[model samples]
Structure formats: structure tokens, C-alpha cells
Target: MTDQAVADDGPGSTGGRLTTRETAERLGVKPETVYAYVSRGQLSSSRAPGGRGSTFDAAEVDALARRTGRREQPAPAGELTFRTGITLIGDDRYYFRGVDAVELAGRHTYEEVAEWLWTGELRPGVRFTAPHEALAAARRAVGALPSHCGSTDRLRVAVVAAAAADPLRFDLSREAVLGGARSLIPTMAAALPPAGGEAADSEDTSAGLARQLWPKLTARPADEASLAVLDTALALLIDHDLAASTLAARVAASARAHPYAVVSAGLGVLEGPLHGAASGPAHRMLTEVVERGGAAPVVADHLRAGRRVPGLGHRLYSGEDPRAAALFDLLAQVPQAAPALAAARDVVATTARHTPLHANVDLALAALSVATGMGAEAGETVFAISRTAGWIAHALEEYGERPLRMRPSGHYTGPRPPQPLPDATEAPSQ
Candidate 1:
């Protein structure tokens, strides 16, 4: 490879280019090492006008040379730092766009809350309206699932159908995405199998999402108070900063994936037991305590078995999770939930007296499920649906950033390429 003459310019000047050998010489490394830098994106390379080996900007080579031999503390394994304006978790509280989530849960509808999260506009009367064809398509898709499928399973299928039906889903413009998400959310909710074995009246759409979703979760008719409790729960769950599923969604969006695919990526991650499905075990624990008529025996048995009391603690909150507290407060006001409320109280009191742990969002979701006579899997459904709003918001944010910005550098710790066996004739006797 010929070494092209680089113009004499100050170090890091952008005026000229350098060839492989010259670049390597300036960086004090071999040509192969220079290629490795290009592969790692530490340097950029281009082919000469004619068919030739790589050439790199002189300034970039100089910059790389200056950075050589500088050591950086490796980031803690799996630790990622990302900036988001959607939600904040601090001081044992959650805020959505600078509004305390607890306060928002008490007052806002899920539609209003979703809009606020997506656009930073807290306008009242924001609604997630969808065309009848979209709803019908989603319903047919969800209905095709097996009888044993859970609500989240049905939801996943419904979202896929909705995406297929929407011809404009590929539009990544801000207004287009926001409009698509607004319609997509309601369509998914409406398509779920109704708890009463019959769909809620289409007119119920105007009442709010909680009303529309109520019949899907329970056979019993929900009163105004109960509907309000579910609405608050949905609002509280709308967003939390950079959850695993949210991160998954953002990653997909950064690659310009369609919104439906982005949401699917998030749902796939949320299906993990350590994430969204955490409420299932928590529901079982609460159910056992209620059946036993006391928290002491059940709590002791769980501890003796080396099983953690699910839903009793959170990694981010030192005390009670604000979402849980808000949800519990609302449940207390519903007369039909008195028994489940009492059981939740006993569990909380017992855990607090025995350990420093406190009630978390999972426990609150479980209590809500039990109180409403919904099945154990209902909490995961609620979590999945509620979190969709957050996932979309994160997707929107990520679309505006550099594509594939989340690609992480690997630090190889595995056995080095089995040190090339010495050439047969050059090898010494072992």
C-alpha cells in the first residue's frame, strides 16, 4: 500500500487525508491495529477515488492517536445511562412530564394522561378514538387465540392486527405517530374478550377507557366508583423512566421500526417473569393470605421456604410505592373491595413490622384484581396495557435521536483465539 503525502497542517487539522501505513505510524501501531480502530468506530475510513485501499481523514487519525493508551473505567455491567423527558423516578415518587403521577392518577383519564405523556399537553377531553373497521379487525385477531389464552396474549394479537390494518403505520412523522398510537390503544382495549361474555356497548367508548376495559376484566357490572379506581390505576401505570420494556421499545424505534413492531418488542420483554409477570406471584401470595384468614402463617411459611414476599418491596423505592399507595387509597373507597382491602392491609402491616419492606405497585395490582374478582393474570394485562402508553412515548422520543445509538461496545473476556498453534516445523518439542 502506497503512503499518500498528507499536507503539512497543524495536528487535528481537517485539510488532508492519510493512508493506512501513515495513519498506523502516527498512531504508533501496525496497519492491522488501524483497521481494528475503524471497525470499532473510533476512526472513519473511505476508499480512494480509484480502486484502492482505505484512506482516513488526517484530523481523525491525529485525534485517535491522542486518545491512545488512555484508560477508562469500564462501566458497571448492564448499566446504561439514557436521557428521557417522559418520566422521572425520585424520592420514592414518579412524575410524568413534571406532574406527580400520584396526583395525576387521582384526576386524569387514561386518554388525557397518554396525550400528556406523548405531547406534553395536559388538555382535558383527549380521547383515543378509532374507526369501526380497526376495532372489528382487532377483535377478529384476538378472537382467533386459543380459549386458554390470557388477556395480554389477546392484546398482543390485537396489536398485530391493528398494525396490519393501518396503511399509514409506516409514517414516522410526529403527528402521524401520535395519531396512530391514539387510535391503536383504544382498538386494542376494545378488542379484548369481555368479562361478561358480551362486548360493552360501543357508546361506552365516550365514557373513558376504564369503562370500556371493565367488562373485559370482570363479569360483574362496575359502578362509577369502581370504574374510577381502575382509571386511576391505568393512569398511575402509564409511565416510569426507562423500564426494561421501555428500553426495548426505544431500541426498536431507534432503528426506525414501525410503532407496532416497537410495541411488540416491548411486550416480548415484559413477558419475562422478572418484569411484568411479577404480579402473578404477588397475586397468589395475597390470595393465600386471604384464604388463610391471617397474614402471619402465610408470611412465615413463605419466609421459611426461602421465598421472597413478592410485591412487598421495590428496588427503587425506600418506602411505599406512590403508585401503590394511590391505587390502594382509591380501592378503599369501593365498597365491594373491602375484603381484599383488609387482606392487603394485614399483609402490609405484617411485612412492615417484620421487615423494612413496604407495599409496591405489584401488590396494589394484585389487590385490585382480587377485589374485582378478576383472575390472577389480570394484573399483567393491566400492566401491559397501561405500559403501552409509556412505550409509545419512549418510541416517539427515540425516533428523534440518532438511529442505533444504543449499540454497546463489548469487552471480550472469553479465551483469546486459542493462541495460534505454533507452525508445525517451527514448533519445539513439548
Candidate 2:
């Protein structure tokens, strides 16, 4: 094992490395435990001169110590600890309220799964209908946006309009919040103008949320297999543990914002390319791959341009993403999805030859959009809508805690405070 040398003037330092005893002391663990961490690949150790003993990198040991919860160093501003019963991710799979998320998605519709997440109850055949006033207001606000506006923008505007129209939006009681969420989610969906002027159908109340969402995404008529994929995607995407958008939503909820505002906070963060918008690039990539009839040149082009090949790898899962696995299984049932799905597989296989990376949810979502003729932004829309339920669940949890508990203290690393103030009359130092 090799690492950049990091010299220190402290005790137990030698030749820019720490002996095993020093590493153990720094980690507040026994020397045997330090060796265990090294064996487990959590930490790495290098050989000392003449192979006398192992010498550990000071930086790596310190990082492992921090992760082990030693308080020798102050926690960074971004490190947050909280308690909740919403979701648990580990061992290449995730669970919601202790139920396997993949299994739950397979067994339940999006609405039912959302209901389960919110209240821990499975209500079969449940439907979320938008209130008349809220739906009308959202529609008006969404209609006012430019025709080329993306779905995330429309959803953001619709949320604000819905909040404004609700007389009881401020009610934070469990029943009231649940009622508001039921109405608000459907309102956001119903507000988007249908594709090709496809009229809103009775499915708004009579069908699943995916059924209502299908026409808005594409003019193509919905097929049973395709609709099933959409529904499962919505269900699978309901929540991941404190994702960036979820953290923003939790922060808003901790500040006592209403459900709509909490959702608005989440949507704002979701618009970033690293989050919900990640699939758009993947969609375009898959489209190019299909047009060129291969994935090699497209993947090479991305690498040559010094860009990451989208739709591959995830930080959380070392193997295939579970959500992607579930979606790919369902997409196989849709006959029209075969070509795009094949393209996605080819991309994954091509990239794996160099650095093996598994397909994530973004790639699967891209294939679905490309195959079904939806716009590039359709995955983000699906993400925003499905995750609204999760944000609400987090809000509900935050509402029960002390207000403003999510506030994180700043760790200033700027110039000393005693420095004299800059004089406006003098030119600023270059």
C-alpha cells in the first residue's frame, strides 16, 4: 500500500508515517482493531523501511477515527446526526420502515407505498385526488409559465400557487398535513398541460398517479407494461435516506414551513444536475447510442471530452443500484423498451471493460424516457413528484421535534477577526 507522505511534528510520528501503536492510539482503539480495519479495507497500511512493521497514513487513520465517532477533532459543518424511522440503506439494499423497499415497490402501487411510508399503513386501492380550488390555482400558475418551461419549474410554480390558495395550508396537525399532501401531490400532477392537448381523463381520480402522469409526459398512448414500469419507478423513487433534496426539505420543515413550502424546498434542490436532473444527460446519451447503433463511440466521446459517462455508478452502492435493477426488470416487459434497454446494457458493458461500473437508476430512467418518447426532463419530473411524499414524511417527523433543530453551526476558516476593516476609499488589494 502506498500514499502521499504527510509529515507531522507530533509524538509517534516517523518518516511521515505513524507506527501501528500510534495509529491505534489516534483511533482510540487497540492495535489489533487497527489491523482489523486495515484487513477490512476500511484503512490501508504501508510497510516501514526494511519491512520492520506497518506504517499507516496519518490522514487515512484520522479519517477512520472521525467515522468511528472519536471527538478528538471537531465535526465538520456538513456532518449531521439525527434519528428517524423512515429509511435504512445498507448491504447493497435499502429498506423503508424496515420493509425491503424493492419488495414493497413490487407489491404496492405508488400511492399505497407512499401511504405506507407516511403512516405505516398499507391501504390497497388508495387514490390521491387534488382539491378543486388547489388544482385550479396550480393549473393557472403553471399555464402562465412559458410554453418551453421544464416540468420542475412548473411544479415549483404550482406548489407556490397551491400554498397560496389553501386557506388551511398552515395547519400542521397530522391529519391536516396528510390531507394537504394528498391534495397537493395530485394538484402538481394535474396542473401540467397534457402533451399534444391530450385531454385530462377521468383517470385523475379513477386511476393510479402514473396513469394521470403518462399523458403529460408523452403523446403516445399508455400501454399496460409501460404504465407498470412508470408506476414502479414512482414507487421505487419515493425516498432515499436524506438525499440532498430531502435534507433541504427537512431543513425547511425544521424551520416550521408548511408542507407545500417544504416540498418547494426539495424541488429547488432537485433541479441541480447532480440530483434529480442527472437523468437528462443519460437520456441524451442513450439517444445518441441508439442513433449510432453502438455505445463505444458515444462512451469514448464522453471520456475524450473529459466528462463522466452519465448513468453509471453511484456513491452509495458499490454494485448495481437496487432501484435500477427493479426498473430494468419491469422495462423488459415493455416490448418497445427493448432497443433502448439494449443500448443501456451496451453502455454499461462498454464502460466496464475499463473501470467496472454498474448501472444506476438514472440510466434505467433514461432508457424508459428514450424508449417511451418522453422529453429528457421526464425523469426529473417523476423524481420530484414521487419524492414529495418522502419530503412530507420527513416534514412530519421534523414537526414533532424541537423547532429549528436542523440548524448547523458554521466553522469559520477565513482570516483572523482582528484584521482591520477595508477602507472603501482605498483601492482593494490585488
Candidate 3:
């Protein structure tokens, strides 16, 4: 209740927490209605250290009510149209504060992307305090990770750790929202190692940073040709049209989870092997086959064994993964790729002829990463590299609402009834 609260209705009430029941009384609404506001992100509440129920900051709630046009005054019984100008969705495409995301990816840094996602823009016109401390705290967590931890896995752990650090992290103030977004993305991305083969001492430009990440698997320098391929791969994977991870992010946002928690939900779902790590195993399968000098027999044996060819199919891309095609086109340009590219082509033809399954984005990217000397397992990081952009966009989409929280329904199927179990020796028998 200590936080400042001011009633938006003519500045009548200001900072101090009010019980939900009391706040509901002032607003002339039922307690359930207040809970609905919290549910719908129209209102917020905080925990009481040693009490039950939640307390609301009068000023903040009033400000939100004012902004939302809620009042003691009556309104027309008919439908009244209100629209959010802050964020928009066109069919399946996403826009933050009206700018197209695909367009923003090339023109913006991860920092700007974060800002746009949280606040719509970074113009001085918008007065939002980016969470410098929160972001720094995230950095320390990322830095403390085992240096040898796979960059993607390390990011997952780092995200969970960062989410646990902030005291006022769930604050949905415009300032806190933007700051959290700005701090979360780069902090997560930075925690991920720079691309493989990047000189540890190189300047930290985007490209240089990418290099450091590339060699983790590649074990050698990724030449200029490979670098170009990597950059384009990143751009292509930057965003997708409302993916599952995107939905998870929005769901968290809707619940008033902080930006980090929103992104955390997203990255966590993306970590599922089916969605995120397909490319990792794909790269390994292809490399092992090619390296072992096997051909149709090996691939056929894989199919016969009832095992999946990891990267051969996709959900969204019907005939082909455009992303894979783009990556492979660039990958083909790498000098070291000539032999592997030919071998991969042969493998693709051979495999496709036998099964309806075709190579997907993962397969193509895994092949390309291998061609560029990215290790057989480098696809995981590459996927993360490309997907982080999408994660930020999804998180931004969630920020327009008030402080977010997520509470999902669980289907409980455990033992029922409260009776104590009979002693073993006294157990009833049919």
C-alpha cells in the first residue's frame, strides 16, 4: 500500500494500498468485478506480507481507471466502441505500435526492438524508464553460467534466474513495461554466446558477436561467405506469424506477468525439442551420415527402424521451408560447403524419393551450419538466434495490458476422498 496511488477521477485519491473489498466499494463494483479487472489486466494488486487477499495501490488503479474511461458515471446501454491504438494485429501479422515487425527487424537493433515491443517506439516523446538495474541483474546471471554451457541452454537457465531477481518486476507501469522489455531481450541474447568462431577479442559489433557464437560448434573460423549466410539466417528466423511461442508470450502478458516472465514462458516453450531443437538433431544426423560415408542404406535403415529423420518435415511450411532454402542458398556459397553440399543434395534426393517427408528449415539450416563448419550440433543456437527476435515481438504484444500474470487451469486426476488409507494388514480384499 506504500506505493503511490492517485484516483484518476479528478485526482481525488492518491498513493496507498487499499484492500480489494475497500477498492471495490470505492469503485461501486462487486469484489468479483475487481477480480475480473485484475484478470483482464484492467487493475493490479500486490501481496500482503502476512495477510490473506491482495491490496491495491489506489493511485495506480485510479490512473488505470481514468485511462480506461471507467467511472462512477453511467454509460449508454448500447455497444460503445473502444479500440487500442497502442498495438495492433492485422489478420495473422503483428505490429507494435503500428510499425510492421518484419520491416523493423532489419532497421532495428535488439534494443530498439525491445523498446518498440514494450512501448511502441523509443522516441524521446515516450517517457519510460528502461530497467537498467533489472537488465544488469540479468547480465550477471548470464555471466555466471558455466562458460561451457551450450549457449541456448544457458540462456534458458539465465532467464529463469533473472525472473527471480526483480523486486518490482511485475509492475505494469508504462515505464516498467518498456524497461523490462528493453532489458530482457539483449540480456537474454547477450547471455547467449556470440556466434561461433567469433574472435574472443573482436569488437562487439553484431557480426563480430555472431562469430564468437559460430565456432562453439564449428571449431574453426566461419569465413566471410559463412558469415553472410549466418546473418541472413538470423534475419529470416527473426519473426513468424503468431507461433506457439508467440502465443505463450501473449498469454503470460495477458495475465500481467512481467516482460521477463512473458519472455521466459516463450523461451521455455520454444525449448521443447519438437519446436526448438529439431535443427540440433538434424545437423547431427546429417553430419554423422555424411561423415561415416553412408548413403541410401543408412537413411533407409533409419526409416525402417521407425525412427524419425528429425529435420525432414515441418508444420507450417507445406512443400518446403523457405527459410531452409534461403539458408542453404547462402550456405552453398561457402568454400568448404562444396563437397558437403553435393553430398547433402544427394542425400536429400535419395531420402525424399523414399518418403513423403522433405527437408525443413531445420534440415536446411543444420546442413548449412555444417557446411560453414558449424558443428553438427550448432543448429540449436542458430534456432535461438533467429527465434529471439520473435520472442521479443511476442513479449511486446503483451505489454499493452496492465501488469501481467498467468494462472492456467489444471486437470487434476489424483486420488480422491480425504479418508485415511487402511493399514496394510487391514486392507479390504474383494
Candidate 4:
């Protein structure tokens, strides 16, 4: 076929065509692998009408690219490890900026803790008040979503809108970025649709970040103890070392993506089941225990079905997750939360009798959700909100480092090559 025919058959044409080098780069392989693909009949190529080389169908190359991309081996050992001065997880404990997270949770507001993480100083009287125009833009953005959408969905929309509205969102200097984050957290919380469509108590800007978020999570009146639980949960969750979402945010920031874009990247990663959504199942599990009046049957059913129990263990912690233990300890003191506390304890005891696994932070968040009558997905919402501090901190850290340093080199492991294609006269008909 002539070059004209190849063009006619390309992507915009009947089928797209790629040169040998383009095809190899698309597949992340050597040029030799392109020949092997042709020999194995995995890819079809046509001789250039007047030239000696071959051209491939762009669509076919794309299909093969997707297949081989999935089969690519995991990154080599130690390749995934990186250094960070953010949260540290070891010895079943978590620390943010060298201070015990549990200790910080007990005394500090989420805003204060977040400030410390971002700047290494626990500055008091930190306010996350959003500018009127930014808040208005974010509210309009959240209002555009469907009524049944969860808080995280609303948050994602609000972040995008806020980014577009802010003229200075691209300012990556530490002070400007930190100022943007400060405004973002409260705007996002205020922008969430008030639970049950009741207007939020806007009169109280003096309330803590958790207080601002409470009415959005549920319509129930805020109890001091319950608000305390949420406040502590927020502080505790402010950061963790290189979580999947944080890593994604850092990667985006490494490329000099703006603060809003960096956070949007993190929220996208957190939407996955294995990450932020893990608490939804854990909440359901605890609810079942409450309804069934015993933990044994629910525990047995989950085990018998070969399903991993949600919220039971952490890969990094050998004993209880310190965050979980601390949250649960506070929940124990809330008289109004006695039922949830009882159910959580029963589940813990029953699970421990059967397996070595102990409760993790997901379980604590779930228990908090159930205990407070928050929405089923409230745990993830709280997680996404609280972790924004960590994501921004990691983004700032990454911005100071070399750009695009997270790019990984791939090692190809495909079919051997050096095979010859059939001669033009002997080649099969199209």
C-alpha cells in the first residue's frame, strides 16, 4: 500500500498508522519487540508503498499497548521507597513532624495541626476562613452536583471550582500555597450540602474545623463529646507517611501542578476501594454486629466466605494502630456513644479470638460514623478532608525537590525478537 493508503487507514482515517519507532515507544519496548509482535501475528503491519520500512495500524498498536501495559512487572525492589519528613509510622505508632499524633489530637484543632505539618510550627489561633468569592464559587460548584452525591464528590467539584476562581492558585511559594490551603479546607467544608437540606448554622465561624464539618456530615445536633471525637479524628488523620493518595499528590506537585490540582489528584486516588473507601465496609460490618446482637456470627460469616475483614489490620502496624486505639479510647468516655463503643469492643474481642489481626484506623472511623449517626460514607469524607493537610504538605516537600523525579524506568520483558517478516511477494493478503 502507498503512503496515501496508509494515511487513509490511519486513526482519523479508516485505521491509524504508526512508524516502527513510534510503535515501540508506545509499547515501552525496544524496536526488536515490534518485529516480534509482527512475527507472532499479534500486530499487523503493511509495507510502506515506496519505502523499505513497515507501518502499523495505530488502533492495533494501541490495543496491544494496553495489554502489555497491564502485564508489565511491578517496579523493582527498593524502587518504590522514598524519603519524606512528613508522618512516620513504626512501632505501632504515628507521628506528624516528630510529634505524637495522638498527643496532638488530644489538644490541638485540625487547623493548628495542619499548620504544624505544613510549616513545622504549631501556630495557635490559625483560621481557615475562606474568602467570600471563593466560598461562593465553591458553593455554586457543589450545588451543581446531584443531591444524593457524597461529601467527597462535592469536595472534588468544589476544589476544581475554587482552583479556577483563584487568580493566585498557581503561586507555589510556601506562604502563598499555605494560604491557599488554609482557605481551601474551610471553603470545601462549608460548600458541602448541609445534611438533609437544612441550612447550616452559618452564625458560628468561631467553631472549630470539625464543628464546621459536622452539620454537613449529619443533621443531628452537635454534642460536645461527639464533636470532640470528630476533632480528634481530624487531627489524628492530618497526615500519614506517603499514603497512596499523598504520593499521587506529591507526584503531581513534583511537576509543578498548582495546589488545587495537587489536591484534586490526591482525592482521585483516595476514591479507590482499597484506600479511603475501606471504611464503608467496616461501617457495615459494625452495623451488622449491632443488629445481630453478637459479634461471633458476623465474624464467622466474614471468615467463612474467605473475605478479608475490613478495618481489622494494618500492614505497617504489628499491634493496634495507635490512631485507632486513641480514637477508641476517647469514644469510651462519651456516654452517648456507649452502644457503638460496646459493639466495637465486642467485634475486636471476637476477631482477636479467631485471628491475629487487630483493629485499624478504618474501624475507628467506622465506629465513629455509626456512633454519631453520620452518613454511611462519612468516614471517607472525613478522611478526604483531614488528609488534605498531609497532601499539601507532601506537595510542598515535593516542589522543593527536583521536578519529575518520580518517573520510573521500565524494564521490558516481552517475546524475544530478531525474527523476520515474510517477503513482500510471500506476504499474506490483507
Candidate 5:
């Protein structure tokens, strides 16, 4: 292939065809950096209707070179047209398509919120076609992961693995980006695979729907109350201001790292006990407390250690997490939620007496999920799975505001370079 053809073939390159690596080399940076450029919409490339990779119009690259002082910075293939003026924090109580996050969290299902962000419609009546093929494949990918892994693990591994599998992960086309996100749902379901196990192909939407998450856990069918509770929980946990995990996700997105990688970064960050993994521990503590007949006492004991309770407070939100209030309200509606709910409250009050910090949503959801039979370990997974909606949204945001690059500001903690060694040791021997 000509150099142009090769450039066109590079991931997301639109002109004559430069492979991402080739484009990066031409631009003088790492392959990952090329993705950041593309993600930021800095680089321009076109997707062939039915082609292997995006083809860049070489002329466009030259135009970009002139625009950004290419000699100084080889901007990636796709660069953002506008600075992401959209700062998520305190801009609103919530948002859905520049709307409200809390409102969507309460009113929308995971699918609906996703549809809203994926398109402007809060409930997309098919303004855009659903990527059924990609959805099916995502389901297969999730189902293919280790069935025994917790939902969080499965969700993480599945998204990462699936991205690795995508042929157009770097394609800059809007439809392609949306299409990739569509896969996360079924992939998540596939990863969960229920306690009894998910079939190779669960064709029914109801079967694969997010609500069905519970049936795989308990022997009983999911009641409307519980499903509603689950939906609300999923929604409330959807997105936060770009958190550390969110930043990690954006880092992956900056690379034009496939959505899978973005989610993987999320799942990985979720692995940290301070973030996504915090819910798992919170749930476990509550359960152990309940089992030991000392929920409050135990929390008080932990408090003496100068540790804030996990899932109780946050850096943001001076008000009760609206997400928590919404979920706790939903939890109240659950038929099974009575005593477990009571136990959680008792624990919360006892802990709060010793500490001014309050119970965050994670605490309530963890208790509620365990009460509902989702299991403590599943809390993080559920959080991972549910937060995926937000993750996808955030990932798209990164897609829009990308080329999220980082520069090191290292501390010179280590010793300086040593002075040159003296002459031959043979002199000492002599």
C-alpha cells in the first residue's frame, strides 16, 4: 500500500490511509497519543461506509498542521471543535442530555438514560436505529467471560475484552461510537450470567434487560417493587462529576481507547476500595454486623480507629445524596426490605451518633441489595454494571472532549545521579 493507504489504514485515520502507529510516527508521538488526538476531535478522518479503518483526507491533515503549528504538536486524527464547556459538577442536580442527572436517575431506566445520552431523546423512539448486531455480540462477549466471576469482575473483563475484539473501536463516526456503547448492556448481562447461568443466546429483551439481574440471583421472580428499586438504584449511581475513576475512564477515552477500555478503566478504578470497590466492603460490613447482632456497635468500634465509614459520606454533596434518598425510598417499597432496612437504619444511626458523617447511597444500596438477595460482593459489580451507563456517558464526553493527555509533575524524592566511579579496582589489589 502507498504511504497514504497505510495512513488511511491506521486506526481512525480518514485520508489516504495512515495506520494509527504510522500517523503517530508522522505526528511524532505514541500510538496511544494518536488516539487522544482523535478523541479530542483534533484529527479529521472519514469512515468508509464498509471499510476496514477510517480513511483520512491527506489534505485535511495538512490543513490541521497549518492550524495547530503541526511542527509543535501533531494533533491526533479527531479534535474537539469546542472546549468541553460541560462541567458536570454542581452545574445541575443531575443531567440527561444537558438536562438533569437526578431527574433522569429517578425517572429513567438504565437503557433509557443511555438512549438519552446516546441521542437527545429521553426516550428514543428510534430516531436512531439500535445496533442489534453489536448488541448481540456484546451479550455474547459478556456471556463468554468466566461465569463465576462477580458481576463487577465480569463487567470489567467483558468490556475490556470486547473492545479488544472490535474492528472499528477507533472509528470516529458518530454512529460507530453509539454502536459500540450499545454492546455494553448485553455484555453486562452476559457477564453476570445469573446464578443458574445465562444461556448462550438470551434473545428476549426481557431476559437480557437490566431488570432481570435479580432472577439470576434468587429463585423467585423479580417483583415490580424490587425491579423499580433496582432501576432507581441503577439510575442514581449512573454518573458523577468526573471522579478519579471518571478521569481514568477519560484517560482511556482520550486514547480513543475503545469504550470497552474506558469501562475497563472504570472497573479497574472501581477495584480500588476507595471508589467502586467501596460498596462491596460496605455491604460486607453491614451483613457481618447483622449476622453478629452488632451493626451499630461494630461501626462505632471502627469509628474509634479514626476511619470514616465507607459508603456513608462523600467529598461532594453536602445534602443527602439525592441518589441515596431516591434509592432508600425505593428500598422502603421492597417487600423484603423491612427488617434488613430497619437493621441498616439502626446501624446508620448508631454510627452517626459517634460521627457527624452520614450514610451515603452506597451504604443504603449495599444493605438493600443484600436484603434483596443480590449479595454483598455483588454490590461493587452492580455498581460497576449500573455505573456503566454513566461510564458510557462519561466515555462519550471524553470522546467529545478528548485527546485527554497527561503531563508528569513528578517529585524528585529519589537520590540524584551518582558521580563517576573512580579508576580500575586493580590499583587497590596491587
Candidate 6:
């Protein structure tokens, strides 16, 4: 076909396609970077028809090049913008600093993933250890909380106590924030009381956060498969692009709150039903589905009560959640997870006939908690712990920005008044 005829066709035409090398050259990047861009969903690639290398749409490539140029320009005055190198969400997948999050979770430990998110560098086999004083204070604060307090409440208290014990907590410098984050994550994990009132283990204090956290969520001994699932979940949950809680953290950091306070702000938002605590309802729903031996009745109950089904859909993804896909792949290896997993699948299939929503990370988390003998609130604990790394990453970014840049003028919508004042003796208006 002639090039003109090919161009007359749509973007799918061969004339509109560029090879990897061409795409790299057009974008002024290396071939490897082109692949990275594709993985990050900045560019999409499709296999050449028969048996050839990947091809990119020429139009798409040029558009991306234009975007790259525009990104270098500064924001206009009186406009607030947040530019981050942390996480990117697009094309039904999420990336952590240009690396595919699922691939990172599969290849690296949670600590390593957390480190990479914070510093953009990976140190394999690195471990986080809580300082003695911080752990002690956190434990004391958590212990003082009423037994009925939820995991998020205890975590909130733990963060406050840890901040109080750190003499250098107010330092917003990069090195100081990094030091605090490295110690604080482990402290949060170790501070929670062990399941069934078991005595704390000295050795657990030095373990990876996932190892330290497993016992706190459930009394069951950690097995190889279950531990793997937990660690992967933590790694995958590290950060999503400006989630509600992460935005809250950045807002606090914009005001120059210390790292601990940044995390506290995040935790405060995280505990709300729509954010971190979302998984708890999913966990309960999955449990009921398993016990009832069917998803229909349980799903019906949710609809009957006028409640949205939990853990089924995500606002950001039209397809399956990448995190859920990764965790479900790991969960398949755990023999104990089969029933819960099946129930989760059934819930999706059942709901699919009507709404066609895919299972989100919360449903996968619910399966993990149910299969591993964790309480309904276990997922919330896991969420709060995992997202601490993300919150700190955002704080680090915000600490470098103009202070209080997030503050905005309110657009008044209320009744404008200077007309009258209510008399104290007059009857109040209905």
C-alpha cells in the first residue's frame, strides 16, 4: 500500500507505526528508555503483525514527545501544581518511579520496594530495625489504648508516641526524614501487641516489617506461602498516584509538618471508611460469602441494605486491578487460600452478570486475611503499615517544594451578609 493511502487509514495503519528504534530517536531517548516508557503507559506498543518487534503509533510517539517538552515549562502564576517522580497510574497499571509495580513486588522484598520508593535506589537485602527508645514509647502508647480500639486508632497513637520520643523529629531535611522513616516503619509494626496476648519476641523487633507485622494481625504461625503473600501485598501497596491519604500527607508536608506528623495526617485520612479501612468491609464480605457457600446471597444482602458491594471496583481502573492481579497470583500458591479465593472469584462472577465490575485490591486483601486466619481489621493494619512508606515518599517530595503551596483561596458560595443580626430575645428562625 502507498504511504498516502496508509496515512489515510487510522492510527492502526502501518504508515502510522514506528519501530522501537524510531520511537526512541523521535523522543530523544535510548531504546531501553522507550521500553520503560511503554511499561509505564506513557506510550503503548503492539507487536508487529507476523513475527517482528514492537511497534508504536507514530502519532502517539509524537504526542508524548510534545508532552515531554511541555513538562519542562513552569506552572503559571497563581496556579498550584504537584509534579512527582514517585508513582504513576495509567493504562490500568501503576508504576513506581518508572518501574512496573507488580514486577517490582514480585522481584523484591517489601523493605526493598519501600526503599526504592523513598530514594529511587534499591539496596537488596536491606532491613529496617526500630530503635529501642522509639519502639518502647510506641508500645506503651499502643498498650494504653482501650482493648476495643481499632488497629488504625492504635497506629495513630503509636505514631504520636514515636514522634515524641525522637529528639530529631522536627528536622525536615532529607537525611533527617530518611532516618526517621527507616526507624518509624519498623517501630509501627513492632508496637502493636501480638495476637492472643502473646508475649512480644525480642527477635521480632529486628525482623523485616512484614515478619514483625504478621504476628500482630493473627495468632496463626506464619507459613512460607502466607508470609510471601503478606510481603507481596505490602510491596504492591507502597504507593498509588496521589491517593486520598497520600494527598493528605503531602498537604501536611506542604505546611512543613515533620515526617512523623506527615504520616499522622495520612493515617488520619487512611482510617476513614473510603480509604484504608475499605479493605475491612471487603474482608467481612468475603468471610460471609465463604460461610454461606455462595456469593449470591451475600451480594444480595449488600444490595438489599442499599450498600455498595465492597472490593469489586476501582474508580481508576476499568479492567482488573493490577495489585489485585498480583496478589491473587501469589495467593494461588497458598493452599489455605483456595476457598477464600474461590469465594472472591465467585463474587466477581456474580456481580459481573449485573454490573460487570472487576475485583479490586480490597477483595484480594480480603481473601488473604480470611485464608490466613486474620481478623476483619487485619487488612486495615496491613494497609496503614504498607502505605507509611508511600506517605514518607510524598513528604520527602513536598519538603522540597515551596512551603504551604497547597493552601488555596476558598470560592465563597454561602450567603453574603452584612445585613442583619439575630436578636437574642427573638425566636430562632425555623
The prediction achieving the highest TM-score against the true structure is 6
Clash counts for the predictions, in order: 1, 0, 30, 5, 40, 0
Please give, for residues 297-387, the per-residue lDDT of candidate 2 as tens digits. 9999999999999999999999999999999999988889999999999999999998989999999999999999998999999999999
lDDT (10s digit) by residue, model 1, range 65-140: 5466422234577887654667888889878866788887788898888888987678897777766888889989
On the 0 to 100 scale, the lDDT of residue 56 in model 2 is 84
Tens digit per residue, CA lDDT, model 5, 197-280: 444344344442445566545545678887777767766666665667777777788778777777788788877778777777
Local accuracy of candidate 6 as per-residue lDDT tens digits, 302-398: 9899999999889999999999999999999999899999999999999888897998999999999999999999999999999999999999877
Is 1 or 5 the stronger prediction by lDDT? 1
Models, CA RMSD each: 14.0, 13.1, 12.8, 18.7, 12.4, 9.4
lDDT of each: 0.81, 0.88, 0.59, 0.83, 0.63, 0.86
Ranking 4 against 6 by lDDT, winner:
6
* TM-scores for all predictions: 0.78, 0.80, 0.62, 0.78, 0.70, 0.81
TM-score: model 6 vs. ground truth: 0.81
TM-score of 1: 0.78
Candidate 4 structure quality by residue, lDDT tens digits, 1-430: 1112323223212235667766665576877989999999999988754564678886687678656652233457765755456787767887876678889889898999998888778788777887789889999988888877777788999999899889999889988999999989888888887776778455365567898899988878889888989999999988888889988998899899999999999999998989998989989988898999988898899999998888888889999898899899989988867777788888889988878888899999989998888767999999999999899999887776657767877777966687688567776879
> Which segments of model 2 are wrong by more than 4 Å?
1-78, 198-203, 418-430
Pairs that clash in candidate 6: none
Relative to the unseen true structure, what is the C-alpha lDDT of residue 191 in candidate 1, on a scale of 0 to 100? Answer: 88
